[model samples]
Target chain A: MTDLPIVLRFDDVSVRHSGSHVDAIHGCSLEMKEGEHVALLGLNGSGKTSLLMAAAGLLPHEGTIDVDGIRLENSSLAEVRRRIGFLFSTPEDQLLFPRVLDDVAFSLTTQGRKEGEAREESERMLEAMGVGALANAAPYELSFGQKMRVALSGALVHKPRLLLLDEPSGALDPPGKRALAALFAAHPSAMLIATHDLVFAERCCDRFILLEAGKVVRDTVQIGEITL
Target chain B: MTVPHAHPAHPLARLCGGAILLCGCLVADHTTVAGLIVLPAVALSALLLQRTRLTSMARLMLAGTLFYLPVVVLASPGVALKGLSAAIVGVATVSSLGPQALHDAIIRMPLPALVRLLVLQMVHQAEVLRRESVRIHQALVVRGGVDGIRGIWEFAKAIPVVWLPRVLFRADRVGMAMDMRGYGAIVPAARSVRWRGIDFGVVFGSLGVAVAAVWFSALVLI
Candidate 1:
């Protein structure tokens, strides 16, 4: 009978791959408010994507990434991951299940639901995301737009509290980019999207953080407060 | 405490029964050749499950058979003709069965074993092919050879050059895709969960049937 207070806070967090001399990121921190739409903008290799990955707990990092005041470490990661959904760039890489239904269903496997319940949930989510017909299609057969939609559904089906997306409009065309901005507007989950698409960053995100060389260059603009 | 399967209560039973059948048959070996005869029928059934265009499958089968004929002949030397015939029959059986039975068979298997199977059979084979090609290319590069197999001079010189980059490019793409999907990165931990006594009984019963099949098949065949 209590609401889960979902919060994500990063403090002095940096990720250095094992055996690498140069850190991917260095001493960068940000706190995401509940239900905030945040955009991460960076020149290539500025560690924006790395920061998002660390926040999602997809990669190991030093310092602390706190989810709702609890830091990411040990068995707590499972609980943290349960509350966060993540998508890596490249549909070719991220969407791997031979069939679309299976890809969506695979997201539910960890939740340990009955097959019927899982199937229903998967179908409902796909339909809601507007890729219902793709349930039987192969991931390779999908267009860039369709794959984006499928990946979104897979990330959202469990209804996670935080959604992390890397390069949401990287490969998309004009209409596709517009559609994605629309998708972002409709979603309820708190999100951190890392991208070089400035137009997309402007339209899709309410708060923008510009990153440069493993550090924040400017924390400017609140789209919700100011007109584009 | 709960499982992914809809009819969760009988999971171990189903797994035990299925494993007993497949492993029992594999161990039964040559004696289970009769069981293997059911392979074609099963392969054909896959067409139904996938709803494949039968004509397309037939074309693929014919092409596959032709390609396989020489390899089977070369591998089995003395009995090439006989073994090749048997192998052709074997492919037909497997093709008919489709992959559903195999899917069912695999579902019972432990997750690590399933992934290991994919890596060993699929990824490992790709790796070996690429490694061998790289070695051959290095040899050609060292001998002051013009690299390609285009326009005679360019073509011959290109053969050594293209294969490495082309194969490597594809592998990189596939590798990135797998990594994004959490392949080999997420390891499933084994947890102790209790099941009903019926689950235990069903599994044991499956094991018994498997033992009997192998024992009886050996006695009869020998």
Candidate 2:
């Protein structure tokens, strides 16, 4: 962890949805260093998704978010998005294209990669996710667990510098969870994952940040402070 | 060896065919032309029927006819039958296109990004709602949750209160997801458009039919 670069920073960030009096996230500050694995933990409606979305530039917020030293603003939104891969909580939401391969290759194509190259990379990514055979299959045809794996492949296909995953282990079976743990171990990019699966988090994350009511209530190094 | 047959008409060609027949149905004045439209519509419907839910399509056509009957009859008794026939042809054309083909047509069209996105989302959410509704109804049947008239009423009420909100929420998520992948607000990279010889053929054929229909309707029907 010595002299590692900062990949993501949130400084006094606050977000409020339209017509809502309360901020979804208020005055939050956080940092994720290069190659770091951090777990974001909180109860439902605790602004976990909001934090990740803000980091991904999906949600507009007050204050500053710097991705790889570039401030996240309207002008830099596209560049920021190019640097961070966001995996939604619901796999169905993320898997947009008709076929699994098409969905996985969507980001690559959007980023100006040729179709053939994007498709080859997408196939390789799906192979890593253990769903290579699902390339031709329609997303609607896959089971929930299969969809989750396919969605993960899509998120990682572009190979961004930072990854923001919301509930990475939702609907995964034991084997699928193990594959995900292996993926986290093998992934070279920094990751900030919001998840309820403490057991799975324990296997991959080195730090934990707990949020309560849109505030960071606890931040701990996962080395010796907590078992999960 | 047997002669290699030509590939089936591309989805775009079928889409153009459907559009032409639908337009003809719209402008058709004489019973003969309207009657002629039924053959192609029926042929297309027969081809597409195998790919879709026949029972649902049949039910929808029946409902449409019932709803259109009174208004059509009020205008002219002779036109009532033709109006019903037109409605059936329209339904059959749509049914034959299938959702996937329709999606392909929209994607290939040089439409504005927002319009394309709206159409895509509408189709996706409709499909999702349809599958979920089927599952819900099946569950209701298995659990004996719906009985007779009351059950139907309950199901109808459940659609608006439960499923609609769920679909809307899903649509919102899909929108955010699209944004994260560099699709929203940003003009996406252009997909390659391949216009085939068959597409040109279809266009020419459609133009001929359109001109003939207009001439026939003008000189004979009026």
Candidate 3:
């Protein structure tokens, strides 16, 4: 475990939105090793989302960030994205396609997979997520929990090495959260989950990192040791 | 929930029917009674078959009428009537076809990948905007932002200021999600839908209606 290679690295990364006087996340540095599950806990507006966005290269950042040894630069952005799966806080924002199956298969289709193959793989992923019956349904037709499951299927279907999930269990019931925790437990990828659900985070993550006022306040293996 | 297609026709067939109806509306001289009657008759028939929601249809009609109000004010009544008729036909055709059907048809069309992608994105973003607008409207109503007609007017006035920034932010988030998912690296493969007897019926039926309407308008003119 000690010899595991780093999956994600952030070196003094700072994110500042345009026209803003202050940084969203300032001097944020962290490392995630292969197959590690890390919980990113913070109060609202504490830059948890901003840090995840910066890692995904979705925001302009001051310092360097690396995914699977590849720097998050313009030239390598596409390649880096290939190795990462990002789940937006709002599932509706990411489920762009009309049909559930199509939305799940979109990642694979855009990666040049054949339609039949992509659909088949998407179906399998949906089944695993317990939303197989929803393949033909429209995204707008789904319940919040179902939508979250479908969105998670879409994120996981491509088998990305690093999973960046923002509030994955935000709208779930207790059973849904447990199901999601189980799914995360089974996944082989490294995950950086931004969440306020301490129980959920504790279930799925081995390490906890707390952010306060755009900076990492605590990093520890014990969840009970971190203060929100 | 599975959206039941109002008719069993394939999406492409429905699209073709819509195209014919639109063309007929554009070409037909709506000043004539026969020309004006043809489109509404065809559109109404289609809408009936599709079983579109009455409220949705009414909303679309109202929007269309409002859009041509300037024509009614500045131009001749006949010109405004023509514009309104065309608008009605356009709305009816789209409503009858449904958004999912339209999406399916466009993705399978022999168009440039970028054009298809742009159209798809526009359709998706429109839905997003509508949802966001509804949410904001509900929030305002619950927060006592709407007390009476005056409050309603104020809310309407604040739309551009309150809504635009949120829309822009959501757009950015959506764009980031797309980029992260590698949306443009390759053209997505559209699943092929087989044509049924109803599809043929729709296409031929629309063609016949369009041709007959044009011929009838010509005869009336003569």
Candidate 4:
């Protein structure tokens, strides 16, 4: 058997958006196995979020992103997208549907669900995330924490194989963070979290990778990094 | 009494509300159309009463209305009053909640049927406008700009790139989130929604008023 159980594999990835002088990230490679939780740590401008986005196939970057033997580069995005759950740091940007129900339902519908099925599934997902109460609420009316829950519910609605979170715990309070950590721990899907919130990275992710200049820097986080 | 928190609406409420709003605009008499003035007043009053601390939207709405009045007057003086009244009513009807809930209500309708509405085109106009404005507003929030500016130069600078990333980012997240949610994966199981007595009363009650108004308007004009 191969020595790796990587559910996700990135090789020699480099991304240069249209007219940028320097590539946003260059030559970054990593492997993540099933049930493996990984943290991406870096300061702003360190390319942490960009790398996560690339892995999630949200952006067009030159690299081989393979999820479960499916290479994202040449593979159909529809299929790749179904297998992945992605969230952005900016909750407002992440929540596209104005209505919480519609937003959550968007992911469900994308997976080829009929209207009725999509609605029910969206409701269930919202409930599981403990924000079902806000299911009919307006996106703009929600507080940042509530918005994050809605976004998370939207991400988890389809329950994809790979879960990608970008600083999910940022706007949350301590209790809220812990609640999210517990959810991550209990979730069956493999997770890759991009955050400067080391506390969250420590709690939700089992493995840690510090990214600098679009490259993997120090690999693995120590126990000292764990702080509630 | 403790104040009640705003909640997500029934799909019927959203669908009927939107339909009535649109139809009412097409047919309502001047007064009914004008009931909308109460909408902004209600919004301000509700905000005042609830006393939630956040950025206010009242001034923005006023400014928008003020900016458009002359153009609207110039175009259709007679319909202007009716149109203004109708708009006021529509706005008031939906406030105390936000756009997302109404959208969710729309989604709650059967998918095939909803798709058909868009295919018919006119419904898509309202749909697209809703999508566009919300998308733009979200972008403003994300870019950390567009918070009701005062300075002319700052406003000028903010005009071009205002809320672009937020709009794009929100658009991106919408799809990803929807897919993961498994929306439209299968026929949604039917869920029961019990309308309060008032809700039923509201529906039939509004229908009666609309019918009466239509008949009366036709009779009077003849």
- DockQ order, best first, reads 3, 2, 4, 1
Residue A105, candidate 3: C-alpha displacement in angstroms: 1.3
Cα-based lDDT for every prediction: 0.61, 0.74, 0.82, 0.63
Predicted candidate 2 versus true structure: per-residue lDDT over A116-216, tens digit per residue: 89999999999988899999877777898888888888888898899999998888888878878878977899999998678888788889888888998
Give the poorly placed runs of model 3, Cα more than 4 Å off: B1-5, B27-63, B135-158, B196-201, B204-222
In candidate 4, what are the lDDT values of residues B1-222, reduced to their tens digit? 011335344545534544454454457443343333322332343233223233334543565467558857686543554454345444444443334434344445555854633322222233443555655555655565545543334444554576455446555565554343433344323346677765554445445545544444444232
lDDT of 3 by residue, B67-130 (tens): 7789888986557656665666656656565557767887887779988888877876776677
The residue-by-residue lDDT of candidate 1 on A20-118, one tens digit each, is 787788887787777777888878888877887777665688888898677888667667777777776755455645467766876776566555676
Question: i-RMS, every candidate?
Answer: 7.0, 2.7, 1.4, 6.2
What ranges in model 4 sit over 4 Å off? A1-4, A73-75, A96-141, A182-186, A221-228, B1-68, B72-76, B82-86, B92-101, B104-222
How does residue B93 of candidate 3 score in lDDT? 59
Candidate 4 lDDT (Cα, 0 to 1): 0.63
iRMSD of prediction 1: 7.0
Q: How would the docking of model 1 be graded?
A: incorrect
TM-score of the A chain in model 4: 0.90
Q: After aligning candidate 2 to the native by TM-score, how far in Å is the CA of A162 from where it should be?
A: 1.1
* Per-prediction DockQ: 0.14, 0.44, 0.65, 0.20
- For residues A23-98, what per-residue lDDT tens digits would candidate 4 score against the true structure? 7778988888887788888777778777877776666788688987788853566677778888878675556554
Residue A208 error for model 4, in Å? 2.2
Supply the TM-score for candidate 1: 0.62
